[model samples]
Target: MDERIEISMLLDFYGSMLTDKQRDIMYLYYNEDFSLAEISEHTNTSRQAIFDIVKRCNKILIEYEDKLKLLEKFMKLTKTKELILNKLNEIDSSCDNIKISNSINEIINEINNI
Candidate 1:
C-alpha cells in the first residue's frame, strides 16, 4: 500500500492509543493534508516540532500495529469477506432458484455490514 495511505489506515485502527496532541497532529497532517509549516502555524509550534511529533506518532502507530495486528486482521477478514461474496454472487447467478439467490444476496449484505 502507499505509505501515506498505510499510515492513515494504521492511524484509523490505532490512533486512539495516542495522546490527544499526537492524534490531533497526525489527523491534521495525514487526514487534513496539512503541511508541516501549516500545522506548526495552526498549533502554535515550530515546524520542526510538528515534524518530530508527526514522526514520533508514526512510530508509535507502527509499533501498536506490530504488537496488536488489528489492522492486519481487519484487512484479512475484509479480503476474505470479499472473496466469499464473489463466490456467493457466482452461485446466485448460476442457480435456478430465485429464493435461494435472494437468501444468498441477504447473506452477502449481512457480511458486508460486518
Candidate 2:
C-alpha cells in the first residue's frame, strides 16, 4: 500500500484513541494534505512542534496497529468478501433452479451482514 493511504487507514482505525490536537494535526497533514508549516500556522504552534506531534502520532498509530491488528483483519475481510462474492456469482450462474437461486440470495445477504 502507499504510505499516505496506509497512514490514512491507520488513522481511521485508531484515531479515536488520540488526543484531539493530535488527531487534528494528523488530519490536516494527511487527510487535508497540508504541509507541516501550514499545519503549524493553522494550529498556531511552531513548525517544529507540529513536526514532533506528527511523528509521535505516526508512532502511536503504528503501535496501535501492531497490537490491535484491526487493519489486518479489515483487509482480510475485504479480500474474503471479494472471494465470497465471486463464488456466489459462479454458483448463481451455474444453478438456475429456484431453490438454488433463493439459497444464493440468502448467502449474499449473509455476506452483506458480515
Candidate 3:
C-alpha cells in the first residue's frame, strides 16, 4: 500500500475522534489540500500553530490506531478478500477445477460477511 493511501485511509477511519478544531485543520490540510498558510489565514491562527495542531492530531490518531487497530483489521479483511478472489479467478480459468473454484468463492463470500 502507498503511504499516501494509508494516511488517507487512517484519516478517514479516525477522523470522528478529533476535536472540531483538529478536524477542521486536518480536513483543510489533507482532504481540501490546503497549505499551512491558507489554513492559518482561514482559521485566524499563525502558520506555526496550524502546523502544531495538525502534528498533534496526527499523533493522537496514530495512537488510537495503535491501541484499537480498527484500520488494521479493515485493511487485512480487504486484502484477504482480494487475494481469495484472485485465486478463485485463476482456478476458474482451469476448466478441470470448477469445484475448487466454487468452494473458494463460497469462502470469499463468508469472509466478506465477517
- Candidate 3 per-residue lDDT over residues 1-114, each given as its tens digit: 775566567789898888888898988888888999999999999999999998898788889889989899997888987887777667667746667777867776786687
Ten residues in sequence with the least summed lDDT for candidate 3:
1-10
Candidate 2: what lDDT?
0.94
Error of 3 at 62 (Å): 0.9
lDDT of each: 0.93, 0.94, 0.83
Better of 1 and 3 by lDDT: 1
- Specify the highest-lDDT model's number: 2
Q: lDDT score, residue 89, model 2? A: 85
TM-score of 1: 0.94
Q: Whose lDDT is higher: candidate 1's or candidate 2's?
A: 2
Residue 70 local lDDT, model 1: 90
Compose the digit string of candidate 1's lDDT tens values, residues 59-97. 998999899999899999999998998999899989999
Identify the runs in model 2 with alpha carbons over 4 angstroms from their true place: none
Tell me the TM-score of each prediction against the true structure: 0.94, 0.88, 0.71
The residue-by-residue lDDT of candidate 2 on 1-114, one tens digit each, is 998899999999999999999999999999999999999889999999999999999999999999999999999999999999999989999897989889998999899889
